[model samples]
Target chain A: MPSPADKTARPTGFRVALRDARGHLDPHWWLVAPILILVVCLYLLPLGNVLLLSVSDPKPGLDNYERIATASGPLKVLLTTLRLCAITTVISIVLGFCVAFAMAHVRETHQRILVVAVLVPLWISVLIRAFSWLVLLRDQGPVNDWLMQSGAIDQPLALVRNELGVVIGMVHYLIPYAVLPIFAVMRGIDQRLLFASRSLGAGAVTTFLKVYLPLTLPGVFAATVIVFVFGLGFYVTPAILGGGRVVMLAESVSVAILQTVRWGFGAAQSVVLLVLTLVLIGIMAKTVGLKKGFG
Target chain B: MTDESAGQDIRLYGLSKYYGDFRALDDVNLHVAAGEFLTLLGPSGSGKSTLLMALAGFVEPTHGDIFVGGSSITALAPEKRDFGVVFQGYALFPHMTVAGNVGYPLKVRGLGKPEIAAKVRDALDLVQLGHLATRLPKQLSGGQQQRVALARALVFSPKMLLLDEPMGALDKKLRHDLQLELRQLHRRLGRTFVNVTHDQEEAMAMSDRIAIMRAGKIEQLGAPRALYDAPETRFVADFLGKSNFIEGKVTGIDAGIATLDTADGPVVHALGTRPAGIGDSLLLALRPQKLMLGPGPNSRKATVETAIFLGTHAEVSLRCASGLALALNLGIENAQALPAEGTTVELGWDPAATVAVRPD
Candidate 1:
C-alpha cells in the first residue's frame, strides 16, 4: 500500500485542499452543514436586510431612530410591550414549575398522560387556539354570562378586548415552552440525595427548601429565559384576543409597514427589538454565568 | 469528638414488611446492645438492606414495633428518630462545600453560626479531612468523598449510626483501608453501629456480632467466632467460609457419642445439642482447616484431584473410594510434603472438630 504522504503528494488543487481540510475536521461536522446553510439563507439574510433597511430605506441616517427616541406614541408602545412580556414570563414560570414537578414525581402512566396534556396544545393551530380564547372571553361569552346570571356580578365583565385578554392569551401560549426545558433538567436530578437529606434529620419542608429547591434552580433559570424571550416576540394570540384595542410592538411594526407604508420606521423598530432581546439575554448570562446556570 | 455517651439499645419485636405479595422482611426479632457493632450479612435481595431501612424508620414495619431505649418508636418519622445514615453511594451533596455539608444537620436544628462552625471542624477532623473543608464534593476523590459522608453523618452525634454498604463502591484496597478506619471509629466512639454488607470477610473483620440473614429472616446471630466455628445450618457454614458437608446415617448412640455409618467406614462423633435417632440420616459440617492430611484414628484413604498452592496454605481437593469429595487445607510445611496430583493420601480429623447441622 502507498503511504499517506505519497497519496497527499499526488493531489494539489482546490478539491484536494477541501478534502484535506475535511480530514482534519470531525465527521459530525458534515451532518450540521445542511442546517447551517438553511439558517444563513432563511434567517440571517432577511435579518441583515432588515438591519440595512433600518438606516437606508427612507432619507437615511438616524431619522427613524430619532422618532423612536422622541415620539411619545412609540415610547408608550415600547413600555407596554416590556410590561406585558414581564407579566407573561412570571405567570408562565410559576404555572410551569407546578406542572413539571407533578410530571416528574407522578406514576409513569400518569406522567405520560400529563406530558401529552401539555404537548397536545402545541400540535393545534395557533390561529385556532387564539380564536377559541376570543370566543370564550368575549362580552356575551359563557364566563361573563355565568357570572352575571349567578349574581356574582351586577354587569357583564369586560374579559376580552383589553390588556387582560392579551396577557391571558400570551401566557396560555407560553406555558408549554416553559415546561419542556424545566422538565428536562428536573428529571436528571438524583433521587437518592432526597432520601439522604431526610435520613440526616431534615423534615419534609426543610429537605425541600435546603436540597430539592437548590438542585432545581438550573431548570428554573432555563425555563425563565425561554418563556421571557418567547413572550417578547408574541403577536398572533395578542392580536386575536385584543380585538384591535391592546397594541403591542409586533402589531405596531406591522401597522407601520402595511397600513402607513413607513418601511424605515418598521425596520428600525424591528432592529430595536432584536437589540433589546440580545441585551437582556446578555445581562442574564453575565449575572448567572452560563456554566453555573446550567448546573 | 463530641461527648461519648453510651449509645441506646435497640430492639425489634416480630418486625415484618410486605410489598404487595412479596415479603421483604419476615418476622425479624433482634436485640442490639448499647455501644456494640452489629452487622447484617447476606446475599443481594436477602432483605439485609430492607432490615436496615426498617431500623432507620424509612420502611415502616407491617406487623411489629421497634424500641430505642425501651420506648416504642415505630410510628415516628425518620427525622424524629435521630439516627444518622451513610447511604451506599455516599450521596454527598454535589453543590455544597465539605464544611457546608457537615454543618447542615446542625443548621436545621437552629444552632448559632459559631457553634455550628466549631462542630463542623471537629467532625471533619474526626474523619481526618480537616484540610479539605473548603472543597466541594465533586472536587474530591472517591475515598475522600466517603470520608466527607462519614463526617456529615456523625456531625450531629446521633443515637445510633446506620450504614448501608458504605464501602461497596470502593476498590479492593480502598475498601480494606476504610474497613479498618471504620472499625477504629466504632471503637473510639463507642456508639451503637448497625451496618449492612454482603461481603463475609468485611463482616468478620468489623462486626462484634453478626446476624446472617437468608430469605428475609435472621438464620443465625452470634459472635463472629462462634458462628464461624459452630454454624447451626449448612447455609450458615457455607456462607461464612469454606466448608465440607459429610452425609451419613446414625448407627449408634452411647454415652453422648454418636457413631455414623458412612459408605467408606464408621465415624464416631460427640453429638451436639441437636437431637438425632438411630437409623436417621444426619448431616455434619466440617471446616476444611480441621482435616489433617496424615495418618490418624479417623484416617481415610483419598486421591488428590487438584492442589492449589496459596502462600499461607494450600488447598487440596481429594476424592475418597466411596465417591465423596473432600477439601483439605494444608499448612505450608505439610503442603511441601504432599505427593503430586492423582497420588493417594490419608485424611483425618478429631471427632470434636465436626458439628452436626440442619440439612437445609
Candidate 2:
C-alpha cells in the first residue's frame, strides 16, 4: 500500500496543502469536534446575533448606545448592578476566605463535612435557592418572626424586595465559586512555611498575616474575579429576591426586550455589559498577571 | 554577623514524647553548651528529628522540661523562644525575594526601614547571595535556596540555631560543601547549633559532639573521635561505622587484663568495663583497619573468601576453621604481596585495638 506521504506528493497546491494539514493534525481532535460544534452553534452564534442586533435593529448605528449613556433609567440600572456586584464580591470573598482557611486546616473528617456544606448549595437549583432566601427574608419569614418574638423590634423588618436582598441572595449563590479556588490554593501552600516563619521569630498573628496570607493571595485574587464576574451576569437570584423593586442591569435588559419590545436596546445593553466584564477582567489580568496571580 | 556572642546553652531534662502507645523520644537528657555544635545522629525512626523539633518548640514533650540559658522555656511559644530553624527542604518563601525573605524576621520585630534594609543586606552578603537579593526563591538553585533560608533564619540574631536535616535535600557534593560552610559559620558566629541528620559521616564531619540515638533513646553521647574509638553497644558500633564482633568466654582476669577462651583458642585482651568470670560469655568489638595480615601475639589462621581493592586499602573477607567470619582492611602495599582468594593466612591485632561492647 502506498503511504499517505507518497499520495500527497502527487497533489498540487491546495490539495497538497489540505492533505498535509490533515496528515499533521492530531487524531484526538476528532473526539472534541462534537463539543466544538455545539459551542459554535449554541453559544457563539447567539452571541454574534446579539452583537448584530445591537447595531442593526431600530435603524442602526449607536442610537441604543447613546440612549444607554444619556437615558436615566438605563444609567440607574447600570449603577445599581455595579453596586450590587461590588458588594456581593466583597462579602463572598471575605466569607469564602474564612471558610476556605478553616476547611484547609481542619481535620480530615471535618474537612469532608465542611466541603459537603459548601458544595450542597451548588447542586441545588439557583431558582430554588433564591426562592428559599425570599421565603426566609420576607417580613412574615422565620427570621423576622423570631426577631419580633425576641423583642428586638416592634415590627417585622424590611429585609426583602430591595438592594440588600439582591446582595444577600447573590452572595449566597457565589460563595462556593469563591471557596473552591481559594481552598485549592490554600491546600497547595506548604504547612512547613508557617512553622519556619514562627520559628524565625514571627508570632502566630504575624505568620498568618505575612506568610499565610501572601501565599494564599493568588487564590484570593482569582476567586474575587470569578465571583465578581459571576455576580455581574447574575439574573435569577436578584430578580426573585429583589421582587421587581431593585432593578439591576439584567432586569432592565429583560424589561426592554420582553416588557417594552425594544430588541435593539436590550441587545445593546447586553453588549455593553459583556464589554464591561471583559474590560474589567483584562485590566485585572494586565495588573496582576493570571499566571503570577494564580501561582 | 551582628554579634558573635549571641547564643544560649540549651538543656533537656527527662524529655520524652509519645504518640499514643509509641514512644517517639524516651527520657532524653542532654546539655548543649553555649556556642557548641551538637548533632543528633540516628536512623529514620530513632527520634533525632523529633528531638530537634522539640528544641525548636514545634514538638512538645509529654513529660519534661527544656531550659535555655538556665531558664525553663518549656511553655514559651516558638517565636518568643527566638530560636532559628532551617527545615529539611529549607522552606524559603516562594513569593518573596531573597532580600524580602531575609528582612522578614526584622520586619516582624518592627524594625525601621533603613535598619531592616542594612540588616537584610548584611545577612545576604554573609550567605554570599547579595547579588541575587531581588530573585525569588523559585528562581534560585537548591543550594542557593538553602543559603537564603540560612540568611533568613540568622538575620534576627536568634539565641540558638536548630537545623532539621538542613542538607538532606542536596546532592552529595553540595551537601559536603554546605557542611564545611556550616562548620565555618558555626565557628564565626559562635552560636549554639543543634543539627539532626541520619548521615553518620555528616555528623562526624561537622559536630563537636554527637548523640547517637537508637529506638527513642540515646545509646551514646561523646565527641566524634571518642564515639568512633569506643562505642558502648553493638548497635552503636554498627551504626557509626563497620565493626567485627568476636564472641568468647572469659577464662581468667589479671591486672585489668581479661583472658577469653574462644571456640578455636584462648585470646587475651583488656578492654571494656563489664565484669566476667570463668564460663561467662562476652563480646569483643574490633575495627577492621586495626587487624593485620601477619602473625602477632594474638593470631588466628583464616582462609580469604574475597578481596576487593579499594584504591588506598583492600577489604578482605576471611573465614576461620571454627566458622567465625572476620573482615580486614589491608594496606595496599601489603595487599599487593598477599596471596589470592581461598588461600590460608594468619590474621592478628594488638589487644588494645579491641573494645568490649554489650551485644544488641
Which candidate number would show the highest lDDT if scored against the true structure?
A: 2
Off by over 4 Å in 1: A1-32, A276-295, B1-4, B253-257, B261-270, B273-275, B291-350
Compared with the true structure, what per-residue lDDT tens digits does model 1 show for residues B1-360?
Answer: 334556888999999999999988999999999889999999998899999999888898889989998899999998888888998888898779999999988998999999999999999999999999999999998899999999998999898999999889889899899999999999998899999999998999999999999988999999999999889999999999989888889999997788899888988777867678899888888889889987875789999999988888899999999999998898888877766899999889888888898889
Q: Give the TM-score of candidate 1.
A: 0.89
Per-residue CA lDDT of model 2 for A153-217, tens digit only, reads 99888888888888989999999988988998899899889999998788998899899999888
TM-score of chain B of each: 0.95, 0.94
User: Looking at candidate 1, what TM-score does chain B attain?
Assistant: 0.95
Task: Output the number of the DockQ-best candidate.
Answer: 2
